[model samples]
Target: MTERSYNSLLSTGRIAGLELSNRVFLPAMDMNLCVEGEISDGEIAHYTARAAGGTAMVITGTGAVAWPVGATSRHQPAFSDDRFIPGIRRLADSVHAAGGRLCMQLCHHGKTASVDTADGRPQLVPSLLEGGADMSALRDNPMDELMRLATATHGKKATYKVADEDDLAWVVDQFAAAARRVKAAGVDAIEIHAAHGYLLSSFLSRTYNKRDDRWGGSIENRARLTCEVVRAVKATVGREYPVIVRVNGHEYGAADGLTAAETAEAAAMIQAAGADAIHVSANAHNPFADFTDGPLPNTVAAYREHTKTIKRAVTIPVVAVGRMLPEVADEMIAAGECDFVSMGRQLLADPDLVNKIRAGERRSVRPCINCYVCVEQNFFDGNPKCAVNPALCNEKVAVLTPIARAQHVVVIGGGPGGMEAARVAATRGAKVTLIEKGGRLGGTMWFSQLTTPANAMLVDWLTHEIERLDVDVLTNTVADVELVASLRPDVVIVATGARRGRPAIPGAEMPHVLTGDGLRAVITGDADADLGSIGGLGRVAVGVGRAIGLLNDADRIRRLSKVWMPVGRRVVVIGGGLVGLELAEYLAERGRLVTVLEEGKHLGLPMAMPRRWTAVRKAAEHGVTLVREATPVSISKVAVRYRVGGDEFEVRGDSVVIASEVCADTSFADQLAARGLNVKVVGDAANVGYIEGAMHSAHEVAREL
Candidate 1:
């Protein structure tokens, strides 16, 4: 019940003359929940949840300044016409009633306007599409995923129209008109979308704005159009309307892009043009691969370095927008780095993030595992759906109604899925018991902290919730029909995770080789049973780790593993999918030479597109060799031989780890079912869904129960 302090983050703040309740702002992230440029009721509900959750300011996703002419999708709301005002008004009123201010981000999708492409109209741009977009990452994309996007596009391709003076005039006029509509609709403020690779931002990119006219060339000229739009928006909305300009703090993966210096200069110009505040964001030129580098970066404080520069350059308040965690945002504000922070993905991960922070239950604020699952839908012009929070798009899912009658619930695993089922069911008045086979609560999730550290936050939060709910938890115990029968549970939720085993291959049983569970066992000192799989050195490492009690702390194990892991200098991983690729990169970072062999053409098939691209890019940067279409033929103590096409080659390795050969495990569920027990299976046990699938599946079944 102790309170956590984040004074600066929770303090009241002002933009222009408008006072907000707190410094936390929800920056514009497209949910694509609009109907032909009009806000849908679903979109309003999504915003209202966040607003009621206690976010001081909630900004709508980009709304087209000129409707279909300047939209990227039919679902993008429009502010150009009066007909869209009613939807805007409803949204504003709802957010206001929920005790939060609302801001509309006015946008005009320029060269990237797919809606224009679909309608056979040229997308307006500062200049024609030229070069500098690095799309090499697209090669790694699965053909089926790419083809689906093509199919969604209705077979139309983008055509561009370089803007002339009149076209520029029209663009500026549209923005002004849009702001007028927003202000009249009772929105608290206006945010002009001049960031990302959108219309106004295209003018700022030196590579794209090749025009010799006033709208292009020098920094001032390149910024002229954006500044003009800011001035027009300010003029239209009146001087004290709290206008914010979202400008790219930096652009990645493109030549002649908005450098840090250029961005600072542009911020000054926008300020001079009467923008009340600056909303700093970064952009990646290549949408395919570089998307994670900006707009939706995977890194923490993704825009902080650039945001600091712009904050120093401008007298106005600066809002930092990339993955702004509460603690980081609070520290940044205290350090005078920025005035406000936008918790975009964090908001999606947990709508009540602000409420949790206000209640001093910061640890209870579910952390976004930095998985790109939410933004992945944007590639297909689809609405945002959070992997961690199933209630994101549908706010009602988190509201657990009481069960019809009092019932005892037995959750047969302590993994995320099992834990979630117990939490939800217990919250709904069910007496719950969580049973785990391992000594600890988190299963693969606890071990996953070694590579993806963010996952540890979720494990910690769920463990805290499990404890807070007073759910009976039994660890270091095996589940069986007898156990459930003893509990006499009315409902049994089985989340026993995935089934994994050693792959059958030449020399597969070599002492130097480790299977997935074998590696985990060695790390956790559970290798007493799997000692045959690891070499003598690994066995010694495990004993020493457990003797010193290092195996009990996942974080300690992760940190010490970097310096002294039992693995060899040269390691080969047997799968190029999510687990294998991430493990390879993690090992490479710790100074181990790593190689990953995949029988398939692509790596990380089911991982979200942005994360998949980033993993592939970073693995290469870390000197990890990824061999596609390579099927392992044999494994020796010294090397792993694999075949790519007709030729076979060997990758030298001191240790080989098999990160593949996993399947769904429903044995326990089947056993319980045979005993006439009311059973529902979830997580990897039912199907190989990993964490996201586990959460969703558990929530679905638990809700029904």
Candidate 2:
């Protein structure tokens, strides 16, 4: 085969005094892979995997610049003292051995630092203000001056001692000291964390900093602390070591927030003050901030637009983030919109993304679905976990290499689990066959893809993997006892999936109503003939009928309403999972008065925290009324009956949509068992979990097989 010639992202790349092998960089991500401010063997292995996979420059997770005051969590690593040097040294050495450059990100959480990690230290800031400090940064003061600022409020301790000029200087000095330590650890470069509303970012935004001093006036004033810190670190580390600043190009909500031009000005000041480059991202503190979307949100292309503006304004290289794909990165670099690409969650999904591109194995690259599990994990789960990459935060575990003895594997159901099993088994040199009752792969995901744009990536990723591994797919073929007996494999994996159970309520047999699966069939034009008897059959109704329950049907109503009753002017969605909430938002956007009623105490309980918050906020913003702690007792033609707080209430709606409860398919499992073949259920087949669980289960089962 002819060698493919391409511009190397690693070769001839230099930022500040440190040289990089490529333009691809692993942006800082909170993996929670560290062990008590130290790098664990898993952290080492995880990073080493990325380096070995061919990342030119790997930036370690955020390292605290100031011990207790700056650290966000107990699991985060610290670069404040010589004690951390050995672990960092090993990380840098490992990257170097893999022919990759390594950079350490010096971070200070500021008000975001949790009190647990602060060890009773006060979370100080430029000003003591509301929304300025939370429980995460609350600190106890022993000093008389600081003690006076402590107040008991709402059964909690609140401190109001603002950080004076002296305090600011001390923080800057701590950052400089941390930088020097990182350099001493033999790391190639240092990146300052000024994004994500951290201490430096809080100072840069007017929303967080309300001081009337020089640091609180204009954009220049707000940016003064950042510039000072950059200069101090540069001076402390000497001229040769590279220093980069990671900053948000836009703060998203604050009207007085820094704009692209102001961000450029700050970047220029940092560069002139000895900074090497600017890693540009967006502020996601506000629900409205564009960056608050998932890692690979559908609007990623729009996010990349801001990078172009910042790149044009700055002289130093600009590292652009915000769900950038390899092709997108190439285009941005080729267009001079960004000098390098920084990917946080994308790297977590596939550390070898760059290598896969270089090897022309793009199909093998795992795509981030932008579900926000990683972010949710960092915030609520106390660790970062990727939905697509189970080994992401737990890279300390041994990578499962192919077993010496390969077994013939039978994977039932062509969803994520089955596909993953087949792919991994095939990779291990096992003979694999993936069987799906439907004519295509992506079982329940097919329905989800229809309703949500973010979920479309799931279908794409699964299909890519199935094809790349050359899994023998037998679609539209039900796996029965005769079939399994004929195939007779060493291991049978039953991902047969689940089915919608009979609704144990009155009107459950209503022809007008539909299950999630039935709705999906209606929306996707795959409705079984059984649904044909529903009244009000017309083009519009049929179209909607065809797309009834598919998750991604942006136009199901429009397509079917012409023949059927136009999607009722008023709509009510039951359940508050990702599907229910998203459908409510979609319908509300289309001018429908939407109401969502959930039986849970909180809306979006089924979803992970941060993502659930994001979805709930979006639904509320779209004028969708969410009724939590309410159970729908009955759905009538004119109103939805529900019980909340032991009180009965009714919501009027023309059309009622059921968004809760997914039925798992278990026929294949029963059939496999009847055949006396060893079978293991995974994904939605075992229980209704997210794609991450399914893929992880599949991978685990494949290893055993």
- TM-scores for the candidates: 0.97, 0.89
- State in Å the error of residue 661, model 2: 3.5
Q: Pick by TM-score: which candidate is best?
A: 1
lDDT per residue, candidate 1, 1-705, as tens digits?
557699999999999889999999889988988988889988999999999999999998888888888787788778878988898999999999999999989889898787788888988888776454577877778777787566435668777888888988999999999999999999999899888988889898886788887777899999999899988888888887899999999899876788777899999999999999999999987877688889888788988999999998999999998888988999999999999999999999988988888888898887899888988788878888887899987887868999999999999999899998998898888999999988788788877877888898889989998898899999878888997889999999999999887778889888778887788886677633366666677788888887888888877887787778788899999989889998999899889999999889999886899899888999999999999999999998899999999999999999898888888999989999999999999999999988899999999999998
lDDT string, candidate 2, 615-659, tens digits: 777888989998877888887668888889879999997667777
- RMSD, model 2, all Cα superposed? 5.6
Name the regions of candidate 2 deviating beyond 4 angstroms.
Answer: 1-11, 115-118, 131-160, 287-298, 396-398, 404-406, 527-530, 533-567, 663-667
Best by lDDT: 1
Which parts of model 1 are misplaced by more than 4 Å? 527-529
Query: What overall lDDT, based on C-alpha atoms, would model 1 receive against the true structure?
Result: 0.87
Question: In candidate 1, which residue pairs clash?
Answer: none
